[model samples]
Target chain A: MAAPPGPESIALLERFVAALKAQGVVTEEEIAEQIARTDRASPEIGARMVARAWTDPAYRELLLRDGSAAAEQMGVSMAGAPPLGVLEDTDTLHHLVVCTLCSCYPRMVLGYPPHWYKSAAYRARAVRDPRGVLAEWGTVLPDGMELRVVDSTADYRWMVLPQRPAGTEGWDETRLASLVTRDALVGVTLPMVAERAAA
Target chain B: MQDDAPPPATHDLGGAPRFRCTPVEPDDAAPPDAFGKRVDALRQLLARKGLMSVDELRRGVEAIPEAEYHALGYYERWLRSISGIMVEKGVVPAEALKP
Candidate 1:
């Protein structure tokens, strides 16, 4: 009898690709072009809600009360998608996001989480040492910051909009929006200061 | 290509060991032609969008000669591991890297 196919054989390649597609990452475009037959994402809607939450105390309270409804109120569609939970980071407890199961996330709000956050190294490490995971992402916690790692399984999606840094007391929404790194918003890393060296 | 890679023995995921599927350097266990294409595919998926670590992957990819680099058998496993590491580092969309 023939040996099972080698890892690089064409048959193996097809199997891997098919397996990956059967998973969700390959489904976004296909979900639109062939399967779902529509284009609907809630990134802008989520972003706006995050911004509003940062601005108004009442709105933030509302968001904490009902994440899905709050997201919808911002004009983001969440039809046929999993539930979303927004995590808020404070001086005491900082949150990091990881998908131990298949990479399930709130794609509607955040668009796409960065690729690195999905590695096996990340999966094992994040659960094993949450603080270490943040360090790799270059997050130097404040003088007294606590770390919390949240698991984003295939069933439920989540997002994070970290607390605005201290210096930008009166910055407008646009400026604040610029501070939200894709990873930070998703809770993998902390919001960073993208300093421009003076000429 | 990492300075600290899991030892040169076959890759052990859980208790099941995945022997060297890609050809290793001549001195290693993989035959001269074992893992050429499998490495290629892993490199392609990792290199897709400046996501995975170039230095590390380049080291692994460059270690094997092109001729023997194309025969790895566990394609799915390679993506799983590659994407796992990528996801670990925040380089893939969670869903994209999910197993």
Candidate 2:
């Protein structure tokens, strides 16, 4: 766990906020609203979209063609965020996302970026040795499969539409979404079907 | 010609060879702590008010010295960037930041 901010740091932040309020630069309600909006965003939003895409062909097409529209279709607000691009992963090809410059994530869909995503090691190796980096996460792709590394930039954010796991043909959207982890959306891992019990 | 190209900024780490040997930590899905959330809220508020843009914040983050960039936490870097931009834009005077 990271250490809490030092007293001096906390004091400075408090003073800064107070000064901003005094100058009518920002109000407490506005700050609280922003926090609430941010808190509402999570990996589940992306997972729901992925699940819908898997079940609805038209929605899938929309998601592939216009990610921002697809996200809004699912009740996610993408008002001020940069355009979102969904990378479709297939059996023959896989996509991995990295913000090589900084952590430019699809926050409106996937919430804030994972801590490791912001690390220098991840930012550096993700583009150079993607397979090796994925290997560290135990996501080993087949030798014949092509691994595509995409850099999510300031102007555009990217998310992965991971291939649906097999043995889930009859699964409902909720059940399918349960299998879609944030790692899968980021293309670091694949969603797997849970084993069933014998009848 | 390759030698004439400017060195990449410290924040520009895409495909950099120096970090090849660095080991990535395991995934931790924990949300930002309270302090981080507050810092993020401040940034969002600033952006909403047209006081700053995401690109300006990124530029401020990129401008940090290499060592300090590595040492600071994620939201701490954001706080620095947001605060710097506020001062740069004359939205909040530098004196207000000092406790």
Candidate 3:
């Protein structure tokens, strides 16, 4: 566990909260609700959306067209977040999303970003050498496949629509979602095909 | 306010070859602690109140020294930016933050 905040920090926090109350910036209930909203965010929401998109072309189109609305259809809330941009990956092209400045991300969908996603190495190298960065994450693309790096700036957040892996033809959405990891949605990895031999 | 280093553009990190390429593995998901929760709450409240824009917060966070930036955790950076902006706007006195 991380160390507790120092006495000075606690005092500062008290003063900060008091100032907010005094200035009518927010009510206690409102702050609680905001925190609760963040609490409700989870990566499963993204996994489910990706699974459904793989099953239904219409939903895939909708997801690509309006990510927030598509998320709302599945009972996910994108409140207080910038517009979501779902990058579609095709057989010939790949997409990787990064926020080169700081870790601006689609928190509403993917919950908190992984620690490495916020690392300076990722922020700098992702833009400098996307293919190499993805390779470091164990993702390699075939030759001649175009890799597009989309920087999610202050005004927008992005996620990758990873291409459905081959050989998962007759699987249910739940089973397919099991293969979608958070890294896949971030464009670092692709969904793996379930091994029948393990079963 | 000008120095030898390039002008302050936080989001202009694309194609900058100065940084080393060492991908750190992500840690397991941990629930927010008291400090992180408070910082997140304060950020939402400040934004809702129109006292601090996201752009302003980004500027403040990016203005942090690179070494400290790398040393601080994700939400820790938010707290640093919050503290800096609050003091700069005179919402909270700097003396109150003195350790």
Give the top-scoring candidate (lDDT). Answer: 2
In model 2, the clashing pairs are none
Better of 1 and 3 by lDDT: 3
> lDDT tens digits, residues A21-78, model 3?
6766667888788788777887788999999999999999999999999998998767
Per-candidate TM-score against the hidden true structure? 0.55, 0.94, 0.85
Model 1 DockQ vs. reference: 0.04
Stretches of candidate 2 exceeding 4 Å from the true structure: A1-8, A194-199
Q: Which RMSD does model 3 reach against the true structure?
A: 3.7
Which 10 consecutive residues of model 2 chain B have the lowest summed lDDT?
Answer: B23-32
Report the C-alpha lDDT of model 1 over A52-85, residue by residue, as the tens digit. Answer: 7888898898787778888887777676557888
Give lDDT tens digits, candidate 3, residues B1-99: 367777646445666666655654544454567677778878977887777988988888888887766566666677778878988998766765665
Candidate 1, residue B56: the lDDT equals 49
> How far is each candidate from the true structure, as Cα RMSD in Å?
14.2, 2.2, 3.7
lDDT of 3 at B2: 61
Looking at model 2, what is the TM-score of chain A? 0.93
Query: Which pairs of residues have clashing backbones in candidate 3?
Result: none
Clashes (backbone N, CA, C under 3 Å), per candidate, total 41, 0, 0
Q: Model 2 over residues A53-112: C-alpha lDDT tens digits?
A: 999999999999999999999898788889999999998999999999988899999997
Candidate 3, overall lDDT?
A: 0.79
**DockQ leader:** 2
